[model samples]
Target: MSGNRYGHSSPPMFLVDSGGGHPGEHQYYHQQVLGQGNPPLVPCWTFPPARAKMKKRGTMNNGMTWVLIMILLLVFAALGLGAYQILRLQNQVERLTQEMPAEVESITAQKQVGLPAELIKMKQIRADFIGAHLIGHADQRSSSGTLNWETQLGTAFINGIQYHNGGFQINETGYYFVYSRVEFLIYTCSHKDSHTHRVSVLRRGENRTIMEDHQEGFCKSSNNQKWMTGSHLSSLQRFQESDWLFVNVSHPLFLSKNFQNNFFGLFKI
Candidate 1:
């Protein structure tokens, strides 16, 4: 039947059934008449292949979206962790500072320093005398004689602008160890008419010359005597604003006998 289409010797209808040959319009058209008398329509299947492709594409897009979301979440989480770490480090530093107990003793070192109260009193007496604190103390130089006399809180009227410790004061006055180191001794007598320089000590009423007048230059020596300065050495003593320093000199430099207005004044202790 497949080779000869026009031959009279053809196969039976039941013989062609195996290959679905009805010889009419189509094999399904006979079922429409024999059974329910309706066109047996085959449902169109367009969604299967396309649905699989769409599913694969949707899966890929969802995977990429998930990856991007994960990356963003990780970045935010990392930033939050870094901020937490910074706060933790700051807390650790604060704890370390608070836990160190030995620093309390180290900060208040004045109680452990030198000079017992006795020695401080003797030095305070010396500060009351010729150690007049002057501010902007000018010596034919740039600055005038200015001193605070309250502490090493300011510069010294001494050498170049280096060490600025004038001296401290004695708050309580009692029996005190006087630490006197005779730095230098200049010996000379006043002119019979006018004035000359010399090293001597004068009591309140009695005038007495301790060292003899040497007509040469000033002599230098190391005599740790409680006798006071042979000459006026600056001892800028610091004092309070309302306190008054009682000036008493062993060798009176500013007085009626050896009087000079520029010797010592204008200080509150």
Candidate 2:
């Protein structure tokens, strides 16, 4: 121990040798003062090196970053695919829209091309029908056993048929259904009185009866009252072009004056 000028004892110095035998190894020293208790040395703890732990943390951080990057990339890829699909659909729609007018025009052109043929077919159908309906005329009387008709009176018409010389001339050759009706008025009842209606066709200056109807016994002789009767003749006949049809009745004078009661009509079948 050594005393300073202030009379305080100085600490004693002690040298400590390192265990290494290498030359010029470093030495450590500690000092302790007399009459002072030495402090207890605390045990030092050594931890593992930080480099490996830092490397593990860095590796974990890199893995997490890579995983996030991959997720982001997948999301972007999905978005890109969706955008491409939308664009493709838009293009298809635009293309179809551009072509629609041409398709419509083509359809219209086809219809236009077929229009004339359809119209011609319809005209032919209309021309194929041959029919005529002629009503009786009150002013015109029967001549040579043939009854005359009104050409332009009520409900009287001729289509594909001609009227000449008190007969209807067929303009087209086909089977025809000919019909005639005649109503008669008798002032006095007589059993012997009879009625006859006949429809005939004349072809090439030759006449042939096609339909005939007879009526009798419709009146009482004892009563001597006014009576009425009717006769209808109808038949299906084949006619050639230029053939003429005529209607004849037994009693022209006694025929009813009503146009509806006396009519001659024929229609091609």
Maximum-lDDT candidate: 2
lDDT of 1 by residue, 1-269 (tens): 22245755433232133354554654454444333233335444446898899999999999999999999999999999999999999999999877864312122212312222222333355544222222212121212211212222232122111123222233333321111111122243322212232222223334343222222222233344222122332222333322222222222221221111112222222
* Candidate 1: residue 198 lDDT (0-100): 29
Pairs in steric clash, model 2: none
TM-score, one value per model: 0.28, 0.51
lDDT, each prediction: 0.33, 0.71
Candidate with the greatest TM-score versus the true structure: 2
For each candidate, how many residue pairs have backbone atoms clashing (under 3 Å)? 16, 0
Error of 1 at 153 (Å): 8.6
Candidate 2, residues 124-208, lDDT tens digits: the string is: 5776656776777785565566888887776677777789867998888888767777788888767777888899889999999
